[model samples]
Target: MDHRLSPAATARFILLLAIVLFLGGCRFLPWRSSPAPRPGHGLQDGKTAGHGEEPRIVFEEPDLPQPAGEVATPARKRACGSPPPPGRRLPQVAIIIDDMGYHRRIGGQLLNLDMELTFSFLPGAPFTPELEEHAYQLGRDILVHLPMEAKDPKWDPGPGKLLLSYSPERLRTTVRKDLAAVPHAIGANNHMGSRFTEDRRAMRTVLGELKKRDFFFIDSYTTAASTGMEEAAALGMKTGRRNVFLDNVHSRDKICNQIGQLIALAEKRGWAIGIGHPNQATLEALTRCRKRLLRQVRVVGVHNLVR
Candidate 1:
């Protein structure tokens, strides 16, 4: 209340004013921490977004239909390959187990299924050579799972991948090396070419190399924007596009449903190709569905479907 205060009082007032001012100014600071997102809010599916971070986009091709619900599996796994009833011309469906060579045990199990499942080997995977040889011996159709740049950089397609920035020569060289890594490969398919396959020029370069070797191309069709199937056809190369992705969900029920979907698609279109991974769920699903599959349609090699 006095005009002037003692030093102690003045010091106390100054300190209080300073503390208030500091607290008030914090709201204007550029680095103010954001409130943590409530659980089940903000970032989802274990994805993060920070400065300069592009939001992730997960693409599901239109052809890949999600299952309505969990499919019921039988207690006893019925034998899969019962020769199609005589005199019935069943539609052909090709099942390609992609991402092979990495999972030796699962791949071996898949090979034993007697479904004539095609095996697509990753060129740089450690078990590729041995598994490729084994698949060849088993008379399974082989494909080079050619790595290519995915739309999401977070998804690594593995080594020796063809990129959109590559020169034609570089793309050709990389493709050749990738194909060489897998012996007995009658053709090649995109492992994850969401981005690379969308670039027509780049795809032409990659497909051109495959054309020279007389190898077919199967577009995994990771993206709807992909020009791989179109470009390959324009080059007069035998080509097929995947109709269904069998195990994107990795549930045995889901995969069995997808296989059912694949067979239905083939019956409608005369032929259909379903691509899956060397996953245990997929192997089990195929084994479980074997009899129903053989009875419904002819399971052929992927090469047979590519045209």
Candidate 2:
């Protein structure tokens, strides 16, 4: 109990105790170094604690408000400047019966088909006016099936000749004569203009005349390189082209196949125009398929469907 230490030894012991207190009080002292894993999450460094692998953290973004006056209005009112009626859908099938003035029996058969058809009459036929009037009276549209020169000389459309060699004035005169021949015609489509339709100048002249008369143009599309559409668009005319020819083969089976193709095109494009002659076979096939076709899509006049 009476043991005492030297002054130097006591001083050394006191210095060691002071050093330990200083280390404990220091806030910035370096401790065991680690990366400080994100707040309360566990590291998935090849450890299997749960049934499956640990769920990864997904950072969520905050919601942002749209700028002032940048909202989109409903499209119906903006383009036409008025809202369209709710229940109306565009017609799908526009059936046009071309070359209607030559044969009375075929024309009569078309009349008895009992569907809304657009009849295009050949100019200067003996029964042009009569057939046009009959078609109109029977609630069908009338179109002037203008005769233009085709690639083959043997296949003539009809009276009026729309040759490619004619000057602009001559072409205009011929078109006027053709239009005058077929009275009460609402629109015009080429009869057989595979050669003439490819001529841009002739097509422009025809389209210009049609535009002046305020008629729609329907390109028959006999050839793949048709400039009729481009010319009509340039002339600012309401126009469309035939998507299907129902009687290209003049057989019942082939015509039915073409009709099926027409239906498919209508389904794909929302509207399709089909042109056909008033042949007996075509008429019979159309009559047989009219009811079933109408159930799937509306069959309307060509003018009613095209804009």
Candidate 3:
């Protein structure tokens, strides 16, 4: 029956109305949108309840953030080895440590070694970003360990492997995305691209993209039939192919022996390139052969060896 509210009641009504309007306005404010989640640098278990003897973690396609603007340039100039002073005639060797991002502990050990080793990082591996930055800061030559389809269907080449099925445009965009995943990569080398590298057309498409970004390529030489070097030559891009695989046998003795072979080749040819993976045995072998490596040949960054 009351015609109007009491003073206290009217004041409360006005206060509530003001609060509602303030709350509603806050939603449309600039800071209201949350930033996207960034990819984590650690391995998370995607385990199922009952699996095999060991719980296997299946890697999924990484949802790395697509950069907003044009791809950022490398933070620092690419690291290169200084030329020998006045041609003393010491043989030059460039040793590249591949498969770096998956095993951080061993990778750290390998990086800490007092050597001018080059590191090639897998783009979407769990520890890729952190390890790659460390390598860059240490003045090491860095490369995107670009994955490409292996010949065998059973051997998955991990995520981001460029396949023959990809259109030329898709290959180009995929190369950009892979390079973006590993910042400060001055170049790229294949991971396990036995099949893709053999396809001259696919290699040409992928390499053209790399050339546009002023990046070099090194064929892993996974297949003897690979046309990587030839395709790169056609594009007139600076390129090289692996001459020696250091850890194929995964033994310290074998690796050191391979290092010796690499040194011998460099001595014979005046320059050579060798690729190794991040392994304890490889690290141990490198540590063991450090004195020999320095004495027998001049160890340089892969950039120096790439023509």
Model 3 poorest 10 in a row by lDDT: 70-79
- Which candidate, 1 or 3, has the higher lDDT? 1
* Residue pairs in candidate 3 whose N, alpha carbon or C atoms collide under 3 angstroms: none
Model 3: how far is 70 from its true place, Å? 41
Worst lDDT window (10 residues) for model 2? 57-66
Model 3 lDDT on a 0 to 1 scale? 0.76
Q: Candidates' TM-scores? A: 0.73, 0.69, 0.73
Best by lDDT: 1
- Which lDDT value does model 1 have at 286? 85
Where model 2 places Cα greater than 4 Å from the true spot, the runs are 1-91
**For residues 61-146, could you state the per-residue lDDT of candidate 3 as single tens digits?**
22212212312222121111233467578888899998777776778888999999999997767778889999999999999989
lDDT pick, better of 2 and 3:
3
Error of 1 at 241 (Å): 0.5
lDDT of 1 at 125: 71
Model 1 CA RMSD to the hidden true structure, in angstroms = 9.8
Predictions ranked by TM-score, top down? 1, 3, 2
lDDT of 2 by residue, 146-169 (tens): 777677665554467688888999
